[model samples]
Target: MESTGGLRERKKLRTRQAISEAAIALFLEHGYDQVSVADIAAAAEVSKRTLFAYFPTKDDLVLHRIADHEIEAARVVRGRGDGEAPLDALHRHLRARLAERDPITGLCDHPQVVAFYRLVTGTPALQSAAARYVASGEEALAAALRETTPGDGRFAEVTAALAAGQILLVQRALAAANQACIARGMSADEREPDALAEADHAFGLLSGGLAPYRR
Candidate 1:
C-alpha cells in the first residue's frame, strides 16, 4: 500500500501527463502557434489555472517533456562510483543509454519520439527554450566538475567549465548525427553500431582533454 502523499504525487503525475499529452497532440495537429493555452486547458479537461500551475509558460508545456533531463549530466557526474573518472562515467552512461534506445540519445525511432524531435527542431520558440535548457545543463555539469576536480582556484574553475562545454558539445554533435540518420529512415537498431562507434571515438578524444581532472 502506498502512503497518502505517494498517492497524491502519483495523481499529480497523472494530471501532468494528461496535460502534456493533450498539449502535444494539439500542437502536432494544429501548429504550435495556432494552439492557445485556453485550448490546451479545455483539451486536458483542466482549468487554465491548473494548467498554469503545472507549467508556467506556453513554451514549458512542450519543454516540460525534457525537464527531468535538464540536470542529467550533473547527476551522472555526482553519482559516479568512487575512483571512476568523470569522463569515463559519462561515456559509459551514454553507451548504456544508446543500448537502451533512450530517446534522449536520439537513437530511438519510436514514431512519437521522432515526431517530438521534429516538433522541437522545427519550432523556433521551442528551439530557443531548448537552448536555454542546454545552457543550464552545461552550467550544472560544470559546477559538478568543479566540485569533484582537485585544485582550488580560478584555473580549476575555468578548466571545469571548458571540459563541461567540450563534453556537452560532443554529446550534442553525436546525438544530432544519430537523429539525422534516423530522420533519413535508418532504424535505430541499424544505426546502433555506428552510433556506438561514434560515441567511442568522440569520448576518446574528450578523454585526452580531460585527463588532468580524471579521478
Candidate 2:
C-alpha cells in the first residue's frame, strides 16, 4: 500500500497532467491567445484558482513540459565524471539525448512533440517566455562553469559567461535545424546520422575556441 503522502503526490501529478493535456488540446484547436484560464479550468474540470495553484501562468501550461531541462546543462557540468572536461561531458550528453530522440534535442518526430514545437514557436508570447527559460539555463550553466574554471574574480566570471553563451547558442542552432527537418516530415532515425555529425562538428569548434575555459 502507498503512504498517504505518496497517494497525495500521485493525485497532484494526475491533476497537473489533466490540466496540461486540457490546455494543449484547447490551445491546438483554438489558438493559445484565444484560450483563457477559465476556459482551461473548465476543460480540465478544475476551478480557475485550482489551475493557478498548479501553474502560476498560462505559459506554464505549455512550458512545464520542458521545465525539467532548464537546469540540465548545469547538472551535466556539476556531475561530470572525474577528469572529464565540461564541454566534453556536455557533448557526450547531447549525443546521448539525440540518440534517445529526446524532445529537447528537437529530433523527436512524435506527433505530439512536433505539435508542441509548432505551438511554442508560432506563439510570440510563448517565444518570449521560452527565452526567459533559456536565459535562466544559461545563467545556471555559467555559474557551473565558473566553479570549474580556472582564474579568479571577473576574469573567471566573464569567461564562463562567454563560454556558456557560445555553448548554448550551438545547442539552439542544432536543435532548430533538427526541428526544421522534423517539421518537414523527416523521421528522427533518418535525421540522427546528420544530427550526430553536426553535433560533433559544433562541439569540435567549441573545443578549439573554448579550450581556455574547458575545465
Candidate 3:
C-alpha cells in the first residue's frame, strides 16, 4: 500500500511538472497577461480544476518555482553544524551552490533555465511575486536565527533582522547581477569568473560589517 501510494505521489508530481512547463512555455511565447489560466490548462492538456489543484493562483503558476527556495535559508540556519554560525553555514551553502551552478543562484546557463529566469525577471507580476517570496524567506530565516542563536531575548528580533537582511541581500544582489549579465548575452559559464569575484566582494562587505554604516 505504501509503495502504491508512493507511485501515486510520483505520478502527481510528474503531472504537476508537465503543467508548469507547459505554462512557462506559453508565458514565454506570449506575454504573461495575454495568457490565462484557461489557456495554460488547455496547453497542458489538463482541466482547469486540475491546474488550480496544483497551483492556487495564476501568479503561482509562474512563481511557484520561487517557492522551491522559500525555506532554504531557514533550513540552513536550523541545520548548521555544531559551533558553526548561521551566517557561516549560509555562506558555505551559497558558495557550494555557486560551484554547483544551482539555478537559484542564477548561475545555470541551460537554455530552459535561462528562459525560465528571463520569463520570471521579465514579467513584472512574477518579479513582484518573487520579491515577496524572497522576503518571506528572509522572515522565516530571521525567526530561525532568533530561535537558534543564544542571546538576549529582548533584542532578538532586531538582531535577527540585521543578520538575515545582510545575508539575504548579498545573495539577491549576486543573483540579480548574474541575471543582468545573462540578459546582456553572457552565458553563465562566460560570467562565472566575474560572478565568483562579485560573490567574494559582496560577502566580504558583510564579513567586514555592513550594518555599522547604517547605525
Candidate 4:
C-alpha cells in the first residue's frame, strides 16, 4: 500500500494537472479572459471548490508552473555545494536548462506553448496576474541569498535583489529572442542554439560583475 504522503502527493499532482490542462485548452481556444474558473472546472470534471483547493485562483491555472520556477531558483542558490560560488551554481543550472530548451526558459517551440505565450503576452488580465509570479521568483532568489550568506551584513540583501533583477532580465531577453526567431521563420530547434548562446552571454555578464561577492 502507498504511504499516505505518497498517495496525497500523487492525487494533488493529478488534480493540478487536470486543472492546468483544462485552463490551457480553454485559454488557447477562446483567449485567456473569456474562460472562467467555472468553465475550467466543468471541463476538468472537478467542482469549483475542488479547483480552488488546487489552484486558489483562475490565473493560477496558467501561472502555477511559473510559480514553481521562482521557488526553484531560490532553492538552487540555497543548496549550492560547499566552496561553490552562487553565481556559478546558477549559471550551471541555467545552462543545463537552456541546453535542454526547457519551456520555463522560453525555448519551447510547441504550438501550444507558443500560443500560450502569445495569449499571456497579449492579455491584460494574464499580464497583470503574472506580476506576482515573477516577483515570487525574485523573492525566492533573495531568500536563497539570505540563507547562503547569513552573516554578511547587508551584502546578501543587496546582492540577492541585484541577482534576482539580473536573472529576470535574462529570462525576458531570452523569451524575446526566441519569439523573434520564431517570427523570422526559424523553427524552434533551429533557434535554440542562438537562444542558448544569448542566455550564456547574459549570465556571463552577471557572473563577471558578481564574481567577487560569491562565496
Model 4: lDDT to the true structure: 0.78
TM-score of each: 0.95, 0.97, 0.90, 0.85
Tens-digit lDDT track of model 2 for 111-134:
999999999999999999998889
Residue-pair clashes per candidate, as listed?
A: 0, 0, 0, 1
Considering lDDT, where higher is better, how would the candidates rank from best to worst? 2, 1, 3, 4
lDDT of all predictions: 0.91, 0.94, 0.83, 0.78
lDDT of 1 at 206: 87
Better of 1 and 4 by TM-score: 1
Worst 10 residues of 4 by lDDT: 206-215
How do the residues 1-215 of candidate 1 rate in per-residue lDDT, one tens digit apiece? 88999999999999999999999999999989899999999999999999999999999999987888888999999999989878888999999999999988999999999999999889998998898888999999999998886668768888888998999889888988999999999999999999999999999888877876554
Best by TM-score: 2
lDDT of 4 by residue, 1-215 (tens): 88999999999998889889988999888988788888998999999999999888778788776776767777777787888877778778877886777777677777776777777778888789998877877887777766766577756688768877777767777777787677566777888788778877877788777654354
Tally clashes: model 4: 1
Worst 10 residues of 2 by lDDT: 149-158
**Clashing residue pairs in candidate 2 (N, C-alpha, C atoms within 3 angstroms):** none
Q: What ranges in model 4 sit over 4 Å off? A: 3-12, 154-156
User: Model 4: how far is 53 from its true place, Å?
Assistant: 1.8
Candidates 2 and 3 compared: the better one by lDDT is 2
